[model samples]
Target: MVGLLPRFRRYRLVLLGLFLLLPLALLLGAGLGAYPIPPLTIPEILLRGEGVEYQVLTALRFPRVLGAALVGALLALAGAVLQGLFRNPLVDPGLIGVSSGAALGAALFIVLIPGAGALETYALPLSAFLGGLAATLFLWQIARTPWGVQVSVLLLAGIALNALVGAGIGLLTFLATEQELRSLTFWTLGGFSALTWPLLLVGLPLALLALALLLPLARPLNALALGEREAFHLGVHLEDLKRRSVVGSALGVGVAVALAGGVGFLGLVAPHLFRLLAGPDHRYLLPGSALLGAILAVSADLLARTLAAPAEVPVGVVTALLGGPFFLYLVLRYKREVYRA
Candidate 1:
C-alpha cells in the first residue's frame, strides 16, 4: 500500500480534472449543433425562454446532451465493474450479452410496433431495458453451479447469446418495412438526435439504479484484485459481488443502448485509459471511467452532429472510429505484457 501512495496522489489530480471537464462537456454538447449557441451564453439563452434559440436549447439539445452523458457514464461504469469482477482487461458489458440483448429489443420494437403513442414511445426503451436485463439474468442462471458461477462459462454463454441476438435481428430486418428498416439502421449505427425528455425520463431512474448497485462494489472489487481465494479469505462475498456486477452492467448497457444504440468502445476505452494512468484501484477507476466516458461521448457526439452540417453521423460510428485504433494498441500491449509475465 505504501508503494501505491504516489499513484493515488496523481489519481486525485486526474479525478479533480475530470470532474471539471464533465460540465464543460455538457456545455459544449449543448452549445454546438445545427443551430449554434455560444457555450458561454447557454445559461442566458435558456433563461430568456421565448425565442427560437431558447426553444432549440431547451427542447432539443439539453435532453440529448444529458442523455449522452448519462449513457456514456453508465456504459463506462459498467465496464469498470465487469473488468474488475472478471479480472480480465478484455471484459466489458458486451461480454455478458446485455448490449446485444438490448439491441435486439430495440430492433424488435422498431420492426413490429406500429404506434407512435406515448405508451409506445415509453415502451420502446422499457422493452430494451428489460430485454438486456433478462438476457444477463438468464446467462447468470445458466452459468450458476453448486460450486459458484463459472466465469468461463458465463463468457461462453455471452458469446452464444450475442450470436443468437444477431440472428434474431437479421430476421427482424427481413420482416421490416423499408422505412422501419431505415430507422433501425440509423439506430444500430447510433445517434442522439432523437433523444428528448420523455425518453430521458424512461432511462433516468434505471441508470441511477445501475449506478447505485455498482458504486458500492468498489472496495470489494479492490479486495478481489488480490486473487479469488485471497479475497474470499479476506471476507469478500464473491458470489454477491458477481451477481450485482452482472445486474448493474445489464441495467447500464441496456439504458445506454436504448438511448444511443450500441455506442461502442467508450466502455472498453475509458476505464482502461484510467487504469493505465492511475493503476487499477476500483475506488478511482470506477468514477474516473464515468467522467472520462462522459467527456469522450460528448466530444464524439459533438463531432458527429457538426462535421457534416445538418447531416448527423451516428455517434456510435464516431466512437468506433476513435476507439478502434486505441483498442488495437491495447491488444498489442496486452500481448507484450503477457509475454513478459
Candidate 2:
C-alpha cells in the first residue's frame, strides 16, 4: 500500500504538470499572430495597466487564444470519453451529429436572421448548445429501450444523425445569400477570433468541472471496455455509467461545438494517439489524451493563424485536412487487424 501510494502521487503530479502547462500554451498562443507580440511582453501587457498594446493583448489575443485552448481541450476530452464509451477508436463527438446540429442552428441565426445584430452573439451560442443537447438526448433515448441498452444501436443512431445533419447543412448552404453563405461556410470551418473573455469565463470553468466529474469514471469505463456482462459481474452498474458518460460527454461536446463550430476527428484521433504513447489504462489514457489533444489543437490554431498571414484560415480546416487522412489510416489498420484475428 505504501509503494502504491507513491506511484499514485507521481501520476497525480503529472496531471498537475499538464494543468499548469495549459496556461503557458495559451500565453504563447496569444503572442503568435499577425502583429506578433513578443512573448515576454505578453505577460507584461496582461499584467500592466491599460495601453494600446495592453488593449490589443487583452481584447484581441487573450480572448481568442484562451478560447482556442479551452475549446480544444473540451473537444479532445469529449473525444476521449466518446471513444472510451463506444469502445471504438473512430468514435468522435462530431460523429453523433452534435456539432453539425449546432452548426445548423448557428447558420439559421446568422443567415436566416441577419437582422438580429446585437443579439447575434448570445443567440448563436445558445441555439448551437440547444441543438447539440437535443441531438444527444434524442440519440440517447433511441439507444435506450425498456429491455436494456445496446451500444450498437447508439452507434447506428449517431451515424444516421451525422448523415442527416450533414445533408441539412448542405441544403442551408445552397439557399444562403452570397455574404451569408461566406459567413456560414467560415463558421462551419471554424475560427477562434470571435472569442471573448466572457465566453471563456463561462466555458473554461464548465470544462474544468466536466473533466473533474468524468476523470473519476475512468475506472468504470475501463472495466466496461472488457465487456458489460463481465463488468456487471464485477459490480459495475451499466445504467449509471451510461447515463453519466452520455451527460458528461454531451456537456463537453455542446460547449465545444457552441464555441468552435464542427471541428471533427479530434475525439477519435487523440485517444488512439495517447493509447499508443501511454497504453490503454483509462486513468492514464484520459489525461494523456487531454495533453495530446491540447497540443494538436493549439498547434493547428497556430498554423491557421500564420499559414495565410494577415488573413487567417479557419482552424477547423487545419484539423480536418490532417485528421481526415489520419482517421482513414486508423480505419484501414483496424480492418487489417480484424482480418488477421
Candidate 3:
C-alpha cells in the first residue's frame, strides 16, 4: 500500500504533464506552417473566419492537427492494451497485419478505381476499413484454440498475414500506372494531407469507439499481466479481454490507415515511454500513452511540414526516422534486463 501510493502520485503527475503537453503540441502544429499564424492571433483568426489566415487555421491546420492527435491516440491506446494483453513489449498494432491490410486496401482502390472524384473521399476509407476488419477476423480465428487465443500462434500468424498482404500490395504496385504509382507510394508513406473536416467525421467516431473499447480494459489487462491463470483466478475474463484488445486495436489502426495512410510506431513508442516513467500500471499507462502519442504525432507532423519548407515529408517517414532508434533502445533495455535476471 505504501509503495502503491507513491506510484499513484507519480501517475497523476505524469498524466497531468501529458494533458498540458497536448495543447502545446496542437498550438505549435496549428501555428507553424507555410503561412505561419502567430499563436496570439489564432483566436482572432478563428473567430473572424474570413481571411486567408482564418481559412488556413480553421479549414486546414485545425482538422489536420486534430486528426493527427486522434489517430495517434488511437494507435497508442490500442498499443498499450495489446502490449498488456499479449504480454509483449515489442508488439504494435501493425504487428497484427492491420496496417499492411489497410495499405493493400488503399493500393487496390488507387490502382483499380482509375477515376479521382467524390467517390474516392468515401471509397478509400471504406475499403481500408473492410480490409483491416478482414485481417483482424482472420487473425482472431487462427489464433483461437480450444483453450483460448494463443499469443505465440497469433504472433506467427500475424507475420504470415503481413507477408501475404505485402504481396498483394506489390502486385497492385506492379499494375499501377505512373501517376497511380506516385499516389500509391505517397499514401503508403503517410501524411495528414487528406484529413480535412469531412474525413474527420468518419474517423472521430471510430476513434471514440476504440477508446471506449480499449481504455476500460486497463484493470483487466493489469491483472492479465500477472499471467492468464492468475488473471482468470482474479475474475478477469481472459478470452474477452483478448478479443476486445485485438478488435479495438484493429479498429483504431484501420481508422488511422484509412485517414492518414500508414502512420507507424506511435503505438510502440508511446506505451514504452510511459512504462519507463511510471512503471507498467495500465490505469495510467493506457491514457498516458495516448496523450503522449498525440503530442509526438503532432510534433512529428509539424516537423514534417516545416523541415522541408514549401515541400512536405510524409509523417510516417518522420515517425519511422524517430522511432527506429527508440525501438533499438527498447531492445537493448530488454536485453540488459534479461541478462540481469
Candidate 4:
C-alpha cells in the first residue's frame, strides 16, 4: 500500500491534465465553425452577453459545444466501465449492438409516424434512446448465465442483435419516403450539430444522473478486474456490480445515442488511450476516459464541421474510419490468443 501511493499520485497528475484538456478542446471546437469564430473571443462573448456575436456564441455554438462535450464524456465513461466489466480491452459501448438497436428504433419510428413532420427533427434521438435501452435489456436477459455472466456469450449476443437491428434499419431505409430516407440516413451516420438548447436540457440531466450513479461503482469495478472469484474474496458483490455496470452503461449510452446518433469508437478508444497513459485503476481510468473521449469527440466534430465545409461529413463516418483500422489491428494482434482461449 505504501509503495503504491507514489504511483497513484503520478496517475492523479495525469488525470488532472485530462480534466483540463476536456474543456479546452470543447472551447476550441466551439470556436472553429463555418463562421471561423476565434477561440479567445468565445468566453468574452458568452460572459458579457453582447449583441449578435453573443447570440451566435450562446444560442448556437455554446449549446453544441456543451452537447458534444457531454456526449463524448458519457460515451468514454461508459466505455471504461464496459471494458472493465468484461475485462476486454477491445470492448466499446456499442460493442453489443446498442447503437444498432438504437438506430433501428429511430428508423422504425420515422417509418411509422404520420403527419408528425415537425417532430421528426427530434424523434430520431428519442427513438434511439428507447431502442438502445430495450436492446440492452433484451441482450442482458439472453446472456444471463447460471454460473455468472460470460463475456463470450455477451459479445456473441451483441453481434447477433447488431445484425438483426442493422437489417431492420436497412428495411426501414428501403421503405422510407425520399425525404424521410435522407434524414434517417444522415442521422444513422451520426453528427452532433443537431443539438439545440431544449434537447441539451433533456439530455444533460439524464447524462449527469447516469455518470453520478456510475462514479461510485469505480472501486467495485476495479475489484472485479481482479476476476470474479478474487473480487468476491475482497468483499465485492458480483451480481450487484454487474447490475450497476450494465444498467449504468445502458443509461449513459442511451442518452449519448439520443444526442449524437450512434457515434462510434469514442468509447473503445478513449478508455484504452487513457489507461495506457494513466494506468488501469478505475479511479483514474474512468475520469481519464471521459477527458480523452471529450478530446476525441470534440476534435472529430471539428473535423466533421470543417472537412467538407458547407457539406459536413458525418461524425460517425470519421469515427468508423479511424476506429475500423484500429479494431482490425486489435483483432489481428489478439487472434492467436483468442483462438487458443
Candidate 5:
C-alpha cells in the first residue's frame, strides 16, 4: 500500500490535468467554427452577450460543445462500468447492443413519426430510452443462470441482440421515406449538428443520475475484479451491483444515442486509454474515462466541423475511424486473454 501511494498520486495529478484541460478544450471548440472567433475574445463575447461572436457562441457552439462533453462522459463511463462488470476490456455499450437498441428506437421514431413538431422532438428520446432498457433487461435475462450471470453468455447474447437490432434498423431504413432515410443516414453517421438546449435539458438529468449510481460502485467493481465468488465471499452484493450498473449504463447510453445519434468507439477507446494511464482501479478509471472521453469527443467534433470547413463530417465517423484500428489491435493482441476463462 505504501508503494502504491506514489503511483496513485501521479495518477491523481494526471486526472487533475485532464480536468483542467476540459474547459480549455471547450473554449477552443467554441472558438473554432465557420466564423472562427478568437479564443482570447471568447470570454469577452460571453460576458458582453450582444455581438455576433456572442450570438454564435451562445446559440450554436456552447450548447453543442456542452452536449458533446456530457454525451461523451456518459458513454465513456458506461463503457468503463460494463467492461469492469464483464471483466473484458473489449466490451462497450455498443458491444452489448444497448447502443444498437437505442438506435433502433430512434430510427423507428424517425420513420414512424412524420413531422418537425413537439411530439416528435420528445418522442424519439423516450423511445430510445425504452429500447435500451428493454435490450439491457433482455440481455440480463438471457445471461442469468441458477449459478450466476455468465459473462460469456452475456457477451454472446449482446452480440446476437446487436445483430438483431441492426436488422431492425435496416428494416426501418428500407421502409423510411426519402427525407426520413436522409435523417436516419445522418443519425447513424453521428454528429452533434442537431443538438439544442432543450434536448440537453432532457438528457442531463438521466446522464447525471447514471453517473451518481455508477461512481459508487467503484469499490464493488474492484472486489468483483477478484472474481464473482470471491467478491461474494467479501460481502459484495453481486446481484445489486449488476442490476444498478446495467440500468445506469443503459439509461446513460440511451440518452446519449437519443441526443447525439450513434457516436461509437468513444466508450471503448476512452476507458482503455485511461486504464493504461491509471491502472484498472475503477475508482480512478471511471472518472478518468469520463474526462478523456469528453476530450476525445470535443476534439473529434472540432475536426468534424473544421476538417471539411463548411461540409462537416459526422463525429461518429471520426470516432469510428479512430477506434476501428485500436479495436482491431486489441483483438489481435488480446485474443487469447479475451477467450480465456
Candidate 6:
C-alpha cells in the first residue's frame, strides 16, 4: 500500500490540474470571440456589468460556453459508462443510435408540430428524451441473446438504427418548408449559438444527476474488466449494473443531444484520451474525461466562432474535423483487439 501511494498521489495531481484548467479554458473561450475582450478586462467587465464587453459575455458568449461545457461533460460521461458497460473502447453514445434517434425526434417535433403555442417550449427536449430511451430499449432487446448481451450484435444493430433514423430525418427534411429545412440543417450540423439560460437551467440538473449516478459504478466497472462471469462470481450484480449504466448513459446523452444537437466525437475522443493519460481506472477516467471534454468543447466553440469570423462554423464540424482522423487511427490500431474481444 505504501508503494501504491505515489501512483495515487500522481492521479490526484493530474485531477487537480484538470479541475484548475477547466476554469481557465472557459475564461479563454468567453474572451476570445469576434469582439475579442482582453482576458484581464474580463474580470472588470464581469464585475461591473455595465459595458459592451459585459453584455456580450453575459448575454451571448457565457450561456453558450456554459452549455458547451455541460453538453461535453455529459457526452463524455455517457461514453465512458457505455464503453465500460459494453467492454468496448469504441463504443460511444452515438454508437447506440441515441443521438440519431434524438435528432429524429427533434426533427419530427420541428416539422410536424410547427408552431405548437406554449407547448412548443417543452416539445423538442421531451421528444428527444423519449426517442433516446426508445432507441436504448430497442437496442437492448435486439442485442440480448439467450446466453448474454452480444456486443457485436449491438454495434451492428445500432448502425442499422442510425441508418433508419437518418432516412427518417431525410424524409422530414424533404417535406419541410425552406425555413424549417434550414433550421434542421443548422441543428444537425450542431452549434451553441442558440443556447439560452432556460435550457441550461433544466439540462444542468439532469446532467449532474446522471454524473452522480455513474460515479458509484466505478468499482463495478473495474470488476467487469475481468469478464462478466468473473465479475458475477466476485459479487457484482451484472444485471443491475447494466440496467443503471444504460439508463444513466441514455439520460445524459439524451439531455445533451436535446440541448446541443448532435455534437459528435467528444464522447469517443475525450474518454480514450483520458484513458491513455490516466489509465483505465474508472475512478479517474470518469472525472478526467468530463473535465477534458468540457475543455475540448469550450475551446472548440471558441474556434468555431472565431475561425470564420463573421460566419461562425458549427461546433460539431470543428469536433468532427479534429476527432475523425483520431477515430480512424484508433480503429486501425485496435481493430484486431476489438474484433477478438
Q: State which candidate has the highest TM-score.
A: 3
Relative to the unseen true structure, what is the C-alpha lDDT of residue 2 in candidate 3, on a scale of 0 to 100? Answer: 92
Give the least accurate 10-residue stretch of model 5, judged by summed lDDT.
332-341
Candidate 5's displacement at residue 341, Å, is 12
Residues 1-341 of candidate 3: C-alpha lDDT, one tens digit per residue: 89789989999998998999899899989999887889778888777869888888888999999999998898888888888877999998887878888887888889999886889888998888888888888888999888989978888899999999988888898999999999899988889978889899977888888888988998999898889889999999878888888988998889988998888899999999999888799988998999998998899999999999889999999999999999999999999999999
Query: Candidate 2: which stretches are off by over 4 Å?
Result: 1-24
Top lDDT model: 3
Candidate 5 lDDT over residue span 219-326, tens digit each: 999999999989999999898998888888888888888888889999899999887777888889889999999998999999999999988989999999999999
Candidate 4 C-alpha lDDT tens digits along 1-341 = 99999889889888888778877888888788787888998777778878877877788887887788888889999988988888888887887667877888888887888457778667768888889889998988887888776667888899888888878877888889987887788877888888999998887778888898777888988888889889999999888887788888888989998898878888988887776676888988887888788889888888988998978899999998988887787778679788889
Query: lDDT of each model, Cα atoms only?
Result: 0.88, 0.78, 0.89, 0.84, 0.87, 0.86
Judge candidate 4 at residue 177 and give its lDDT. 94
For model 5, the local distance difference test gives: 0.87
lDDT of 2 by residue, 1-341 (tens): 88677666666665676667777777777788787888777767767777887888878887787677667677777788778878887788776657866877887777778667768676788888888888888888898889666778987998898888878878878888898888788778887877888777767766777777677788898898998888899899888887777777777878887877867677777787766654577887787677767767777888888889998988888888999999899989999999999
- The lowest-lDDT stretch of 10 consecutive residues in candidate 1 is 114-123
TM-score of each: 0.96, 0.91, 0.97, 0.93, 0.95, 0.92
- By TM-score: ranked, best first: 3, 1, 5, 4, 6, 2
Model 1: per-residue Cα lDDT over 1-341, one tens digit each: 99778887999998998999899989999999888889998788777778988888889998988888998899899999988988888886798988888888888888878554666566777777778888888898989999999988999999999999999999999999898898788878888877899889878888899999998998999999899999999999889988889888888898898888878999999999888777788998999999988888988999999999788888989999988999999889999999999
User: CA shift at 181, candidate 1, in angstroms?
Assistant: 1.1
Q: Which ten residues in a row have the lowest lDDT in candidate 2?
A: 6-15
What is the descending lDDT order? 3, 1, 5, 6, 4, 2
Clashing pairs in 3: none
* Superior by TM-score: candidate 2 or candidate 6: 6
After superposing candidate 6 on the true structure, give the runs of residues whose Cα lies further than 4 Å from its correct spot: 1-6, 115-122, 143-153, 336-341
lDDT of predicted model 3: 0.89
Q: lDDT, candidate 5, residue 110?
A: 91
State the lDDT at 22 in candidate 6: 94
